[model samples]
Target: MPRTDKASRLIAAPPARVYAAFVDPDELLAWLPPGDMTGRFDHFDARTGGSYRLTLTYPDAGTGKTTTDSDVVEARFVEVVPGVRVVQAVDFVSDDPAYAGTMIMTWAVAAAESGTRVEIRADNVPDGISAEDHAVGLASSLANLAAHVEN
Candidate 1:
């Protein structure tokens, strides 16, 4: 069965600033990867129907990368609303069969008294990505986002 993972964070920034982090490639590369992973984009277009390919690599040899030391994802923009939300249809590019299939990921940003409330929701997650691990990854990414936008 497919799983769903969700994570929320209260970032010390406005909605537009927080939302820009996802729309801009440089900003996205700055905060999207979890842990010590570094990200590089093959191509990015932040409009509906636009697609991008990104590779996130770990310095070590055995970091969930069997074929290579990088986790690659190809994603298309399903919906993009400035300062509000972004919906992406993502596919993990891996030789590992467990990582196959498409996932729907949503980033929702809302105005708050002090800052913005950002929530990330992923649906139809493949079994390859365990819930526990996904949660940790999401939380880490959110924290990184907070740092990138808040600072």
Candidate 2:
């Protein structure tokens, strides 16, 4: 069976602002990367069936892990609903056979009492990615988002 990762957080921002953080390339760069990583998008189109390429780079070496300079992702939007949801088809650019297939990442945004409830679900995860690491990465990204939007 394929592996999946799910993470959720209550962001201290409205649904529209939280949703905008995902689709806006500039906002994405501010919050998408986890921990000591940074992100840059080649180009972004915020519509159904639109595609984008992003590069994530790690700048620090203290994590005790030998890592690549960058990880690239080529993704397309499968579904897009303003302030509500986004479903993406993502493929990592890697030579490893285990990471060759396409995975689905869904972002569900809902209106909560004071802010927005954001949930992320990643399905068909590549075997090359460690589940524990991915969980940390997901949680980290959410925390980054909260920090970006709440301040």
Candidate 3:
């Protein structure tokens, strides 16, 4: 069984704007990242049973340059709560061999005094994936999301 790592972020944007990021492919393309990588959604249905694919491009970290061309990763929505929550399972296509199986990610959005509080509860992490790494990634991605919505 995979342990779950929960992460929360506060965004200055309202729940609606923050929620829009998950449903709007265009918004997703603008924010999903690790600084060195970015992605574009090929197709996103954003509803339960909906399947989607995103093409990710990673820049060479060593040289801080773009290295790999866009590559695809696919996912399917398991649940959805409009402007509030989403649960999905995602997997990557890897040649590195260490990466395998799908991971489940749940995104919950709540209205707050400042704006929106976004919580991510991720589970089914593959063997090679570390909790620390997931936390960092989720935090960074949330930061990116906050910035995106703020802009």
> In candidate 3, what are the lDDT values of residues 1-151, reduced to their tens digit?
4677898988999999899898888888777775667777778898999989877776653321122454467899999989889999988666544456788989989999998999998787766567787788788889889989985
Overall lDDT per candidate, in order of appearance = 0.91, 0.88, 0.79
Clash pairs, candidate 3, are none
Instruction: TM-score each candidate.
Output: 0.96, 0.93, 0.86
Model 2 poorest 10 in a row by lDDT: 60-69
Q: Which has the higher TM-score value, candidate number 2 or candidate number 3?
A: 2
Where does candidate 1 stray beyond 4 Å? none
Clashes found in each candidate (C-alpha, N, C closer than 3 A) = 0, 0, 0
Tens-place lDDT per residue, model 2, 1-151, is 5798999999889898899998999998998999889888898997999999988888854332224677889999999988799999999888777777889999989999989999999999988788999999999999999999996
In candidate 1, what are the lDDT values of residues 1-151, reduced to their tens digit?
A: 8888999999999898999898999999999999999989999999999999999988786765434588889999999988799999999888887888899999999999999999999999988888999999999999999999996
Ranking by lDDT: 1, 2, 3
Clashing residue pairs in candidate 1 (N, C-alpha, C atoms within 3 angstroms): none
Better of 1 and 3 by TM-score: 1
Candidate 3 Cα deviation (angstroms), residue 147: 0.4
